[model samples]
Structures are given as structure tokens and as C-alpha cells.
Target: MRRNTRRRPTGARRRTFAAVALILGGGGLVAANTYASAGEGDSGGRVQDQSGGDQAATISCPDVGQQLTDVPGEARADVDKALANLDQQITEAYDRLTSTRQEQAQDGNFVRNSILGPLSEKRTEVIGQIKIDVKRAGGTAPEALDGLAACTEISPAQAQKNDGGGDGDNQDGDADTANPGTGQDDGGQGGEQQDGNGNGAAGPFAADFVDITKVQPNVKAKPRRTGDASTGTFSVQCGVNENKVFNTDNLIVAPGVDNGAHHTHDYVGNQGVDAFASNGDLANAKTSCSEQGDKSSYYWPVLRLQDGTKEFDAEQQGGGLEGNVGKILQAKEAEITYIGSPAGKVVAMPKFLRIITGDAKAFTNGTANANANWSCTGFEDKVQLADKYPICPQGSSVVRSFAFQSCWDGQNIDSANHRAHVAFADAEGNCGNGFKAIPQLTMRLVYDVPAPVIENGQVKNPYAVDGFPEQLHKPITDHDDFINVMDEDLMDEVVECVNAGRQCGAGAGEQPQEPQQPEEPKQPEEPQEPQEPQQPEEPQEPKQPEQPQEPKQPEQPQEPKEPKDKPAPQAPQEPQDEPELAPEASSADADKDRAKKPGEAPDAPSEASSAPSDAATRTQEAGAPDDARGGETKARTTSPAETSDTGVEAQSEETQPQPQAGTGSLASTGADLWPAAAGGVLVLGGLVLLIHNRRRNMTTN
Candidate 1:
């Protein structure tokens, strides 16, 4: 069987390849351009509104919470002190700007020029100070702190550190760390030149990059509460299939829609996928998951195997990320499921609800990174070292899993950015303070990497995924997103499945019952086209109203002209390609395949109906199952019993390992390794590792 390669080349070949490939592509190129034009480039190229007259410039710094997570106790005080002063100045400036007129608050140029721009400059100055304190404390500054300069919507000093204007290696042409909060750089930063903040310098494109250090797996020891019992569960066997699970850019901007992913990604589910998919489009599109009613879409980046080669040369391609492209492979299975119960009665989801799982900005960050998951398929209990990609046993595939937030804000199905309205359930499966518990959605991605081979009695694995060698150390580019475009009724069924605690998919305890076949209804007679020869008889009528009515009758007959008109002009068929109707038609057809009896009349009478209810009925069963066990909405505030499949259960604190405290002795050193390795030990280990990896590759190949 074909497997995705995870092996990476070492020694001379690896170094040679790294030397030649164009290192600036994706976010790196964007960072470079940003710095090159730092003195001249305006707020991310956005035209500044000349409306607001110049007010005294104020500096508004980013919130400390957004920039750093879990700072060591010893450093938090200094970091907080720096942020406090910066924020105070920003607040004063903001007050001044908004004191005279509220409109000034909305002015982009005014905010950037008077507020954010100054804030960016101040931010840099303070970060430099923080670095001093860190050094004084005999520790290295955190990457999150370094990324503060580019945190604003518009940063005039955006490229200061990346463009070789700041202190240290970051200013010496080394790549910066990824932006805080986001694992990858923002859209404009999609390149290989700079790493965004202060992570490291650019290396070989195909060289292994491990974004995050190995943290304890978030997996639970036992099932834990995912939702309250007051609300009944609804589950959908969102299929193992994929509509377009390819190695390309695919981000869901709206339900059943996508914002073209500039970086390569793995897409699955909805077929009406594009940059402009709306809720209606998602409602209409067919899904590739289980032949069930749920049609939510899910996707993430594609994991490839770098075979010790620089697949793309940036200089040859005029300098771009594609010049670093490597061999992309297909994942074995992309399983996505939506399981949740409504708080009370199921209401239609507010249209176009968007949500993301995992941190995109922290993908390459070593501290507090939540995005990377490393383990062999079956031996999920055993996590490999974060610095090294796992060499799986011959049969198992490499797995990258993503679990999305389930708790909803009851009031709004979505928020401005699509994330504020939804949140992850706490360890007890209870919703956060203001949010209410809803269904949880979890997606699992599995890939089959080439098996290890034995060479001269040594086992070695040498495959790897393509990544920015300068910023990342492992193939840790994993993130997932979802847009809930489910028809309201179908969503209700998903709620029912979750509340009942009944498993509904292949892995779930219960098998998905085949949808009962609905008998076909009688077909209506086709309306014939009105004959042109009959038109001459209409004018003979004496009464004007009667004459008009006679002519209108023919027009009504023309309404049935779709069959003749559409069949004659094939160009009209293009409308079916529109997300509005084609998705529903195809999804309905898929439903029919599972539920409609042979020769049963399709729901043709309602074909012309544009009502969501009409279309929803065709896709799901008419009634919810009564046998499921769960209470109606209760007022109990306490957490409820645990439920959902093995995949949907929440992880309790006992199961989740807490992070260790203190920067410790290692913080003073550059790397996360326990201690500096002696030369002899390093050389011996490298030789053994290289030999082992090479042998495994030789045997597998």
C-alpha cells in the first residue's frame, strides 16, 4: 500500500538542498516585503481615510494576554510591567482620539498613524527592554513577546525585526517566530523569508520542522462529559469520505464555502466549496461523509513526506513558496463528525457560523503550542518526541487530530469573527461563564506513512513533510476549521444523537440504521407548450379583460416551458452549478440513494419549492427517534453525565497533564533540550540516528 513519507534527509545532501532552494515564500516573502517597505508601506496597504484630521499621535499596544500564554512566574512581573506602561499610554491616546468625536475612533489612518503606529514603535522599544530583563534574569526572551510588534491590524514598524533593524539574530536576517495566536503568518505574510517574530532563521524547505514541543497528549483516561443531559443529544455520521480532500489552499469562509487557502491544506466534506460559499450554498451542497443528513464541512493542511530533497527551487521559479514544494501524499482517512444536543428546542443556527480549532499562529511556536499532535495510529498512548517525527510500526499510519469548540453563546449562533460565539467545554464538559453548552464537533485525520526498513540490522525511517526549515523543526503544520451550514432540521437531528448518548457511526457503539425507504409518489402529468396557432384566436374576444386573461393563460402555459427551454439551451444548465441549487439537488440524490425505495417517485412536486423546510425533509427522516434516553431541558446548573463517541468526550484535568513551571536552567540556553549535549554524545547520537533512519528507509523502499 502507498504511504505518506515522513523521513528527512541528513548530512551533506540535506545541507546542499537547503543552500539552493528559495527560502522566501508564503509568509516569509510577505514578511520580507513588509520590512523592505516598512518606512514607506502604509497600514498593510489599506488606503488611509483622509477624513480624520491629524490628532496628536497616541500609542496603543496589544493586550498582553493575546501575545503570551503561561509566562514563567519569574518573568511575568517584568513582562506585565512593560505591557502595563505601554497599555496605559495607548489608553490615554485612545481617550484623546475619541474624546472629541466617536467617528475618530473608526478612522483607520487616524488609528494607525496616531495610535497603532506609535504603539508599534513603543512596543519594539519595550520588547527590547524585556529582552534585557530576560537576559539579566539569565533567561531568553519568549517568542510571543517578540511577536508583539506585528500584532496590530496596521503596524508601520512591521518589518523592523524581520528587516534587520533590531537587535540579535532576528535583526541579522534570521527568520522570526510565527505570529502569536496564529501558527502561520497572516495572509500577507504567506512566504518563507521571515518566520514572523523571533523563532529562528530560514533553513531548507524540505527539512523537517517541528512547530511545537512535545506536550502531554490531551486525550482523556476515560469518557468525560461533553454536554449536559438536560439537552438531548443529536449526532450525525458525518462521513469518512471527502469531497475534495486535496493538498491545496481551502479555508471555509462561510458555510459550505471557503476562502482560498494560500498555503496548501487538506479539504474534505462539502462540494460547493469556493471562496464565496454562503449558508445557502452550504445548505445546498452535497457532502462526502456518511450518507446521513449532516453536511457540515471540515478541513486542515495536508501533511506531506519530504524525501530528503529540495523539491522546488525558489530561484528557478522567480522566488516563491512553491519553489519549496515537496511530494504531497493522500491521507488514509479523514473522519469528521458533529455530535451535540441543543440546550432546549433546536433553533436554526444563525446563518454562516464559522469556527476554528487549534492555534494557527502558534503552529511553529515551542511554548504553549496547542496545535501539534504526534503519535502512531494505534499506539496513540505513546507520543513520540516533539523534535522527532514518529517512525510508526509497519501497519499504523501517522495521525493528526483536531477537536473543535462546542459550547455556543445561545444568543448568537455566530460572532463577528466566527469564534467569539463558540468556546470549548471546560474539563467537566460545562460551558464557560457566559456561554451555553452545545454539540461538540471533532475531526480525526490519519495518514499512512511508508513503513520502516532495516538496513544492516539497523532500523531507520527517513521520510518527512515539507515545511520552512528556518522556523519549524517538525512537520507541525496542522490546523482545522469548520463552517456549520447544516439545514436547521438536520442540525436538530445531530442534537438528538448527542443528547441520547447513543453512538451512531462506524466506530460508535450503534450502527447507523439505514434510512427507511419512502414509497414513490405518483408523477404529475407534464404540461405541454401552448401552440402558437392558438394565439390568433385570443384577439377575437370582445371584452378587454377577457382578452387579456386569455393571453395570460398562454403565458401560464409558458411557465411549464422549462423542460423544452432548458433542454434546448444547455447554457441554462449552468444555474445548476450555482451553490444555491446544485448542492441541495446532489445532497438530496445522495439521501435518495440511501432512503428511497426502488422506482419510488422523487419529491418532484416540491422540486420547485425554495423553502428550506421542503429541502430539509427530503434529506433527513421526518421524525426524531423516541427510543433515545435523555431528559428534556432542565434547570440544573451542575454538569451532566458523560456522553458522545470516544472521539467527542472532553478531557478532564486528571487526564490532561499540567505544564511544568519555571524557565529553569534550560531557559538560559537557546534550545529546549534538557542540557547542552557534550560533543562526543552529540556526535555518537547523530551517527546512530542517521544510520537508523537510513536503514529504515532502505528497507521500506
Candidate 2:
């Protein structure tokens, strides 16, 4: 009736309504996604609080020592004590922060009021004392030092970024994909339960580990060696802390302070090393090294399996009480090698020189000074991870390697920050800022333990390196300490050998001679055989009886000639055909001997030196730095010389390696923004269609 004259609801009107609905729906999705992205970006890379609020994951303070470059020698002791107190204050505050999580969840200001406020106050007092110490010692403390007293809280995400995402967890909630379960039983100490946040007494979140096989090869090529390069290598047979030489003290960092490291360290070289040990004590102490000449103290954080086993330090301050718990794992192999500079001749390390490589607080301090190198035995050639603990494949042992700084300032044996006195060489292997090249200490530690398991975002039978309470046992906090205690004669010999480009050390002499001994007889025989014929003719002319004696003399030489020709030629041929064949053969034989007698010396010098060539080849082929892991050759934010405000020369930026891109952060960003961007496009398209339909409807009307 009315429809006969009135216009019915047109298809254009229906299309207009559909387009409007599409625009509304797409706009809502884009807005929601934008809000979510903003929220995540604001999280500041911190571990999300399980109680549904954002809280600090760890405490961070300015490194006061890094700024005290010119503390007078007299003030160092007082300043050191004050600095150690600062660390203690932070440790106490961290304990409070972790223990009062419920309080933090209840009150937003709890961390600031109950934890950080008190910590800042304590640090301020300590900083004031440090200033007074320097002033009293006729040195000036920077007024800017006062500003360093205040500390702030950092999120795990921020820390991970600073560490270049070494912990293997992406901020985009992709940890489940990064770490997959192997269906293996939790094999170490059993019965340890993780809290809801994936932390326990000593933590290593499931995100802290990665399937090593999944990591891309990041080892760079070795620095090119020049004519002045020190190509020789000096290795020492340091038993793998077999005698249980473990301590939680850092002699170089916090002398005279107990529990200085707040974690256990496996010490191998010096027998009497502790926070209070004087240089004299180290020099006179017995050593774990096969050569008593190498009394240098070598120590690093001990690795432990979280299997519910109580260790000697379990109840001690630097152990379980400080959050370093679990069954300590002894390294199956500990290789300590001192290689010469690749740029110039290496001088002997100054006796009593203190060197601390890798920051012990790297998890909190950031990776500017972090020098951790982790990989598996079979995969070390392919990849090395700086931040993540590798879940090594079956039959592969976990490897932790450290390459100490090799460039030494001509003046200081030790600097206030410890790092200012030494620096790593450039990518081209040249030392900068007039720093002389010194023997580079490279350490390789292998642990034979069941691979840690992760399932449903939980880690089982987790293994972690010992570290500060706030550090959460992250692998990036792994570090090593060294104090040169080598006797003058031994040090001189090391320098001579390195300069001469000869392999010399605990096992160098024993193994190389065996390979060359089979070749030695061939040389003497060539000259002796010609002399033998002439001698026989002369003897025969002198007397017929003498002829018999001359024949006997020739026979003696001939006897060795027969056997030497037979096996000597064959032995030399085997070595020539495959240089590594002799060493592998010798290693196999040594392994048998070792298997037969378990109580015998764990590492024989011959066995240790047998594969020196092969090891050297691997070191070069893997593109590892001559001084440390090749992957650690990142650009330094602070120059070693610039760490001192005094007349120390500044290191040239051109000499430092450029920071590589992919090495900085591993979190995926572009892929995450795709869905949001796509929705935005859809919303725009819907708006365009709605406008077109509305215009058509208007025309029809």
C-alpha cells in the first residue's frame, strides 16, 4: 500500500550499514592493540609481578668505584671498605625486596619506603665516607659523586636488553617457543620446587636457558695477526679444583671483606687466596697448577645444580643465605692457557697485578663489562651465547669460557675500577692508548652434568652460576678473577717463550718431542751411513781382524737404521698425513690409562699437551678472540684510559670495534606490530566504503 509510492529500504542503505559496522569493529581492534602495545612498551622490560602489579625486578645503583678513578693510593683501603659496605647494603635491600613481595603487592609505595629509601640513605653515607677518604689522602673526589648515591629499580626486560637478550626469553611472551621440553626426566638433585614466578632459593628462570642448537653462529673471525704478533701459546695444567678449593671471597675486588663475592668461586691456581690474602700470601701459597711456578690465583663463579643437595656453604653468608644454593659441580676439564698478543710481543704480567674480567654484577650492572662466554663442547665451533645458559645436546658437556683483557697500561698494576688498568685489544689485535700487550689469559671450563629440563614454562634440575642475590643466578653474571703471582723466573720464561713463538708450558715439552723424536733418527742416519762405508775401507786396509770390528761398528748403526727406516718413516708419514692424528692417538691411549686407574693424577702433562695443536686450530677456526671469546669484542662504552680523570690518555674510538647490530637485542619487534597495522588498514578501508555507500544513498534520496 504505502510501498507503492514510498521508496523501500534500498540495497545502498543496507550496504551503508554493513560498512559502518565493519569500520566500528576494525577501529575497536586497532585501538585495543595500540593500547596493549603501549602497555608492553611501558613495562620497561621488568619481570611482571605475579600479583598483578608492576614492581622492580632488581635494584640498580651507579657504580661508585667506576667513577673513583683517581683515589689516592692511601685512601684505597678505606674506600675499598666503604665500597664493600655499599655492596652489603644493596644485598640487604635486595633480600628485603624479595622477602616483602606480599607487602609490595599490598602497597604501591612499599619498595620506595621500606627498601629503596633505606638503601639510598645507606649508600649516601658510604659515598660521603669515600669522599672524605680521598680528601684526607690529598686527593679530590668529584662533587658529582654525591649524585651517584641514589639508586633505582630496573625491570628484567630492561636488564635483558642491556644484556642483549642473552637470557633467551623474548619480551613478546615467546619464551614457550624459545625453550621447548626434551621429555627427559629431571635428573639432578630432585624435589626442588619453583615459586609461581619461576624462582626459588637460587633462581635461573626457564627463560634463562635455551636449546643451544637453536642459536645462530655468532663467533666472529679471529683478529688478523701481524708480523709483530705473539703467536705462541702457553698452557698450564690446573686441575679442575679437584681438591675442592672453593671460596666466596674476591681478593681483587673487595680485599679484607668477607663474603665479598656473595657467591662461591672455584679456585684453581693459588692455594691461599681470600679477601684478606696479601700478595705475599699468594706468592708463598701452594698452587693447584701442575707447575708450582704458577701460583697466580684464578677463580670464577661455581656452577651448581638445583637438586636439593646441601653444600658446605649452604648455610654460609655467601652461599644459600645470599641466594647461591644447590650442589656445586666440579668442572670436568679446566684449561688455562696464556697466549701472546696478536699485534706485538707480549710482556710478562706484572707480579701481583690484579685483573678482574667480566662483571660479577653484570645481571644488574648491564653487559658493558660482561665477558661471559658459554657454549657446548660439540657446538662451541658453531655458536657461543653470552647471556643464556645452554642446554647442551646429549653427550655434550656444558662449557664456560673467559678471555681476560690483554692490554695493560704502562703505569698501573691495578686501577681503582680494576678495569681502567687493562683493556681488550682492537678487532685488528692492536692495543690502544699506549697500553702494552700482555699475555692474554684464556680459560675453558667444562662441566659434565645432565642437561637442565624445561617444561610448561618451568625449569627442572636447573643449573646456575653463583651470583649476587639480586642477580638471580643469571649466566651473564659469570666472571673470573686473577692475581699474578708467578715467580720472576717463570714469568720471564713465559715472556721469552711467547716472544719466540714457541709452545711452552706444563705439557708443551712432553708431547711435541714425541712427534719429532721419530723424525730425529732419520737425520743422524743420513750422515752416519756415508761415514760408515769410508770407515769400513780404512779399517780393512789396516788389518783383517780390524775388518771384523769395523763391520760390527757399521752393524750397530745399521741395526737402528733397519728399525728406524721401517717405523720412523711410517710414524712421520702418519703425522704428515694428518697432524692431529698423533695427538688423538696419544689422547686415546692416555684416556685408557686414566680409565684404568681412576685415582691416578687426573690430568697428565703428556695428555694435556697432546692436543695443543688441535686445540689451537679450533681456537683459530672458531674465530674466537686471541684474548677472549670472539663474540665478546663489542665496542666499549667507556674507554679503559678515560676511566681515570687524571693524565691517562684517552683511547681512540676508531681503534674500538664497532657494535654489531643483531648482537645487541634478540627480541622480535616488527613481527609483533603487523596485526595492529593490518587492522588499521582494514579500518581505513571500511571508512572509505561507508562514505561511498552514504554518498550513493544521498543521491538516490
Residue range 1-701, candidate 1, lDDT tens digits: 99969767655456334333323222344454445444322222122234422222222233333434234446645655564455444434444443433344345355556655666777688878877765676666567677766423312122111111112211111122211111211122111212111111122211122111122332222122222332222333332222222323233322212112323444445644444345666677666544335556665654533333222221221112322233334443444444443222223454456766543322223322223444554434323222224555444555554556556677764442234566654433445557665555555455555543322211223334333222232334345677776666666666565444334433433222211101101101112112323422432221122111122223222222223333321122112211222234434433223332111112311111121211121111101111011111110011112212331211222112101101112232223222223333444445555566567667867
What is the clash count for each candidate, in the order shown?
64, 5
Q: Please name the candidate that would achieve the greatest TM-score relative to the true structure.
A: 2
Let me know the TM-score candidate 1 reaches against the reference structure.
Answer: 0.41
What lDDT does each candidate get? Answer: 0.36, 0.60
RMSD of each: 26.4, 19.2
| Cα-based TM-score, every candidate | 0.41, 0.64
Give the distance in Å from residue 137's predicted Cα in candidate 2 to where it truly belongs. Answer: 0.5
Q: State the RMSD for candidate 1.
A: 26.4
